[model samples]
Target chain A: MLASIVNPLILGISIGSILLISALGLAVIYGAAGVINMAHGEFIMLGAYSTYTLQSTMGMPFLLCIPCAFFIVGIIGFVIERNLICYLYNRPLDTLLATWGVSLVLMQSSRLIFGSDVKYIAMPEFLSTNLELGILNFSTFRLFLIAVALILLFITWFIFYRTRLGIKIRAVTQNKEMAASFGINAAQVYSITFAFGAGLAGAAGAMFGALSIVLPTMGMHYVVEAFLMVVTGGGSILGTVFASTLAGEIQSIFAFIFNDTMARGLLFILIVVLLRFRPQGLLSTGSGRR
Target chain B: MSFTRRKFLNTAALSSLALAAPNLWLPGAQAATSLKADSPIKVGLLFSLTGSLAVPEEDSTLVMQYAIDEINAAGGVKGMPIEPVIVDAKSDFKVYSAKTKEMILRDKVISIFGCYTSASRKAILPTVMQQDNLLFYPTCYEGAECTQNCIGTGPLANQHSFDLIPFMVDNFGPKVFFVGSNYVWPKESNKNAKVWLERSGGELLGEEYIPLGSSEFGPVIEKIRAAKPDFIFSTVVGASDIAFHRQFKQAGLKVDKMPIASLTTGEIETAAMGAEYGAGHFLSAPYFQTIETPTNEKFVDGFLSSPYGKNGYTHYNMEETYLSAYVFKNALEKAIDMHGVTDVTPRKIRDAAAGVKVEADVSPEGLVWIDGDNFNTWLKPKIGQCQADGSFKVIKEAADHVAPDPFSIYPDSGKCTADGLLGLDGKLKVDLI
Candidate 1:
């Protein structure tokens, strides 16, 4: 009985780590800029495709591809912000529609170029094996994923909390007019912030691409969970972490008691009920937007 | 009646029109007067050219075209070239229904040859039945319904599980776990597998269904680890297949020790998941590209020469799809020969298909014949282990064609006949009971 309880908790953390990695980019973008970026999933897809191209054409190692994917996707994100997103600032609905359209375009573009075959990312031989600690057993690659997620989270926290650019981004996020009056280039900060968020997603993609098959529509699977985590966490980075882990644990426990399908259905119902009771979300601020 | 120059030309045209008018209405016309002697016989190539299911379905479409081209090059079928009216279903069931309608009603295609997933096949079922058109479906599926309008060219439940389970029990231990995507096909497949397991005297460790296209398998993995099944009978389809294999490999599971005996995984998926992930796993299918038969070699060579066969790997689905076109062609030719060219119709061709037998040299898989009883093809079930090159290494094959039994799960359920399903008590039933 104790084994059952402990096992689900550990498995839940593993699941939560995956959810957090995928949702980190969405959380950063939404939390910092208050922009409901629907194209975030496609950005991760692009990161996967970028890694594929670099690995196949340039013969880069898998470890090298992760950073390459980050920079490549970050550049694309910067370009998208400067050209498209900069004009839709403060218009949440318009941003939402535009990003959705962008996502569709990106998906179609990849399909046309890559054709619809599933692509694979080769991982290191050691990472492909399993790791076991007594009753706790799982994939070594999954443990690596958890480690990567934590490192990315730590870097994100450091950038936002310990850096000068973090203050500018937060200041602009809190009050765009006041930040602009204070000589902060709010547009530049938003651009950098969006790029950084996209870069984080790219890093996540490199890991995810190794975990599963890489395809044009792979983003569809992750984007929903990412959106759910961000919404449940109230668009806060730390809150997303806590909410994702909690949700994962609950889901894992439910699955242990029931089955996968039932657990997922119950999880969705619980999320609905939780949102109904706490409309502002788990740890969101109870203040109106400036 | 002034016989001027203009009047003479008008009189001549009227006389020719009157002479040709009877040929249009006469059923006994010696030739196809409705079409020019060189006009092609139009058929619809309906498949998802885009969207989630496009990967394998698109390959099916390409193989269909290649088959049509081959038949057209060899003096065409019954001296009439085959013209394909291609349409993209976009992996949507609604789109499948609409496209089937457009093909039958507007394009006037003789038949449609497509559909990989059972959902799309069911979606277009009503359209084909209502229009009284023929559809050649070439994908393995959970068998229950037997429709004359739609001919199944792939293996059914009996051909796959009946042959696969016994082999697995003999080779591996009898403790099997069932895992599949949450859908009708998977559920029905598992249901059939359960019956097979019982008959084989195997023990069921666990059964789980993961949502389609879902990548998360952490909890499911934990369950499987705990159960310690000797082997897994997997019906997971699409992208999820890749995820399952990759995760299973990463979880330190030994494929040689506990192989995934799959109905869905093929060369395409194995290639996508990488050879390392799929290596040593078992797949049950009717055909594998690595088959060393001279006929398969020629077929593989022909596919490689085609534009879409750049991947250089073909599997059961593509082989079945390739042969379905030939099945249709052979049936049409037989119909034309029997009833004359002008009297050939979809119904006549569908009826003639019951008698059509494709020789082993013609079909890469082997001799194939449509079972007049259930409208499903007789196929040889084969088991192949995944190799390091992402291709199957054939290990076992049935000696001959296995009769398709769509209602194999229910022993006394009735057999499909011309009149309908006929039960054991000499009573006629409308459908499977």
Candidate 2:
């Protein structure tokens, strides 16, 4: 009987690991720029595709290819921002539409080049095994995912809190004009910030690809969930982590208790109520929006 | 050695008798007894190759190719070679509908084969029904649907649930718990399952449902443990199903004591779950990738050699899609022979299919026949259990080659049950005392 609770909880944590990695990047972008990066998930797709191409075409081992995937997606993100995003600063809604367009283009390109077939990454040796602690069963890869996410999150948190660049970025986010007057070079900062967010998403994509089947439209499917995370977690980084873990647990528990449709419907209702009561997410600022 | 003998006999027969496949020849060329065989027959392969269903869709597409190659290598199907026109539905229901229409109307395919999920099937149905085109649906699904123009090559509910209930009742002694993803499909499946479970002298400990793609299975598993049913009848679907199964195993539940007999969990899904998590699953599908036979061996060999096949994507729906090509071919040949039709008209091809009895080597069952109602009899469900080596072992048979009773009574349709599970007929097979 105790096994029952521990099993679902472990599974929830595994799923949460994936969600947190994927959502953290989107959350960072939105938190920093207040620009809802709709194409955030696309960066992950690009990363996955990069890994796919490297593995299938170049015959590179996946271990050697992970960083390559990250860098390639980072470059793509940087390129996209430098070319398209720089023109639309201060226009959040337009940025949303523009990023949405970018997402469509990326998805279409994947279909065109890859023929829309499902592609998979050879799961690493460590990923395909399980670990047990007493009665609690856990997947090694999922635990590894949590470890990677925590490291990246810490690095990002440290960069945002301790660095001179971090202060400048916050200044730009809070007041771009003032930051510009202070000679902070907010434009370059925004560009790097966007690329940095994209890289994290790329890393998430690389990890997710190894764990699950990769397809062209997987990005859009994840984008919705990421949006949910950003909305539910709001602008608070700590809150995002809390909500991410909470949402994962709630979804898992509800799924365990009821039929999937009812569980999801109930969760949607719960989120709505959460929004009404808190006006943001459960851990978000009041009237918090994605 | 037996296979070698069979091949030898085939070669000897080919040389001794200048047998012409009359069905494969063109009208004017039939007088010559033998015909030319250079031009390949191009058939379109459509599946949700992207998005949500892409995993299974890719599996099916690869399997389809494997089957086509296997058939063609054996001197082609009825002396006509095959060419695959592949398209991806991208897991969009609209794409399935529109692209299928385009394949039939504009591309003028000989026959169309693809699609695994219900959403894709439903989206593709109206277009096929309206156009009266031929489609071979290759997935185990709810039984309420029937299309005269389509042959459901996968097991329907009656073929699966009715037989399963009896088998479980005899083996486990009539105690069950029905768990499913709550939707039209599972609800309908549960209703049918209850009727059978009660009739088979079994007790339903509990029935529960969850949303589609749900990840948790704790609360339900706890309740199940409390009820202590002999086995679980599950119909969970998608990625979340993976999470549930993983969690179920993680929870330290006694799987050996209570096996999960599921509708949605099949060879395709097991491969997706990967070997580490896929063990201990017992499932039933119309066909499985691991059935040992010449046809299946050839199918497996071809898949293992292919790009996607190397990764162990031998899924149920994928193999079904692969077998469906042969089904379409057999039907078309019969139609053309019977009607001298060359245009690939839907009515003509469908009529031809009704006349043909196709035998694909890789079928879980040895043979399949299409009934006059456009329902296939050969697509019988085969029981499988996941083994350590990333494959399902065919442990048993569901029926003596079950034929779909398309005209069975539906509660919504006011149709009564067909041949009863209580005795032979479905009528008078109520759950009441």
Candidate 3:
């Protein structure tokens, strides 16, 4: 009985961390910039490809590739913001379409360059093993992911709450015109915020690429869940975290009772039901900012 | 004027005469060397160059070209140079159907070689049959299908599972778990394995199917940990195979203790998943890159030297695709001899494919022959254990070519002969399940 209970919970937490990591980037972008960011998954895919290039071609250590992926994708995100996204700021629908087009370009470009074969990202020797703690037996890499997710969350929290840029970002997210009047340079804040969020996605991709296979279309798999956590969480970081954990546990419990397919189907149904009841989502922002 | 009974009989008589003694009856046999020095026999190379199926299908496409080039270098098939009319199906089933029509009706290629998934093959089946064209499919599939329009050169369901299941049961315990991608191929392959498992008195602990391209194996892994099955019979294909192996490794399931014996994990997948993750896991295929035969060695060396050899590993899919071109070549030669060089059509080539046989020298897999009765090729099954060097080490192999039994699960199995489904009508019949 204890094994049964602990196993699902541990599995739930493990999957929850994966969900949270993947959702963090989308949440950050939607929360701050109010951009739906259709290319967020591609940004994550680019991060994985960046990590793959670094590790495979450059022979960089896997631990170093995560931050490198962040900066690499972050730089790319900065360029995209300056060139395209900056043009369609108040035009949310246009930004959505343009970012989606950007995603298609990125996907095709990666296919051409990498040749669409699945590539592997090697992890350190220690992380490949498992951790057995009585009834709580799990992958060490999963535990590492949990730790990484927490560290990332804490850092993002620190950045958003404890920094001067955080104030500028929050101010801009609340009122772009007012922040521009206050000399905050709301456009610059949006660029930085978008880059940061993309960097977070890149970081997630580094871990994810190591976690699974790397392919040109691997982003499509994670993007759905990322969007789910973002939308259901009302586009806030804390809300995403809570929603992922809750969703993971619920999925785990359902999977434990039934099977993975049924669990996934039931989870989608439940999410639909949840959304129908609460149109503003599980946790709505108190701020009256669109 | 129409496809009259007298016209059909005459065509059939001519084809049978050609099959019996092509060298004796062909008046063009003497003039063949002078007939087609400039004119080339066009064959369609239909494969997905983009989308989800592109990765594996890329090698298949390359190997098809390599085989065609090799055939052309060897004095061409019946003194006519073969030209490939390549087209990307874009990994869509509808595109496969459209391309089949376009290749048959528009380009008028004699024969086509392509398709990795059974769905794509099924999509093109009606078009091929309706247009009386031939499609040479090269992917090992869950075989409950037999058709004259398509010649399957890959291993059938029985060819893969018959030997592997018994081997697993004898080596490991009797408790087996079935995991596959939720699709027709996996489900059918698993169903085939279940039949074999029952024959060996093995118990199935659990059977589960995950959606295609899924990465989260945690819930499934948890269930596996709880069940403690002796071995896992995985049919998970594509990129998902990489995650399944990595997470299985991370979940502390030692291959020595409880191995993942799979049908889908090949050289490309194993290399991409890493040797560390796949080491000690088992796979069953008709061909592996590590096979120590002169034919396979040459094939591997030639593929690695090719422009499309960047991935640097060859598996059964490529080997089969390569051999399939040779199969088509041999069949087309007979067809050309039967209907003369200029008069050869897809219908004539499809007729000749039934009697075509390729020897060991040209084929990487030894001595593959298209069954004149069923239009499926005979294949040798091999069980390989994944090594730490990202290659599979052949553990066991069939001493002889295993004849394909596509409908082995049925009591009236193998009844669908060359005359087509149930040996009654020559119409296309696919997917028993």
TM-score (2 decimals) of chain A in model 2 = 0.92
lDDT tens per residue, model 1, A148-224:
88998999999999999988988888888899999999999999999999998888888888888788888888898
lDDT of 3 by residue, B262-354 (tens): 998988888888888888989998889988889889888988897767678888898888888888888877876777766666666767887
Q: Candidate 3: what is its chain A TM-score? A: 0.98
Per-candidate chain B TM = 0.90, 0.80, 0.88
Q: Candidate 3, residue B201: CA error in Å?
A: 0.8
C-alpha lDDT score of every prediction, in listed order: 0.86, 0.70, 0.86
Candidate 3 per-residue lDDT, tens place, A1-290, comes to 79889889988988899999999999999999999899988999999999999998999999899999999999999999999999998899999999999989999999989878888899998888998887778789989999999999998999999999999999998888999999998889999999999999999999999998888888888889999998888788999998899899988999999999999999899889989998677888866877
Per-residue lDDT of candidate 1, residues B60-106 (tens digit): 88888889889999989868999999999998999999998777766
Model 2 Cα shift for residue B200 (angstroms): 4.3
| lDDT, residue A215, candidate 2 | 65
Error of 3 at A60 (Å): 2.2
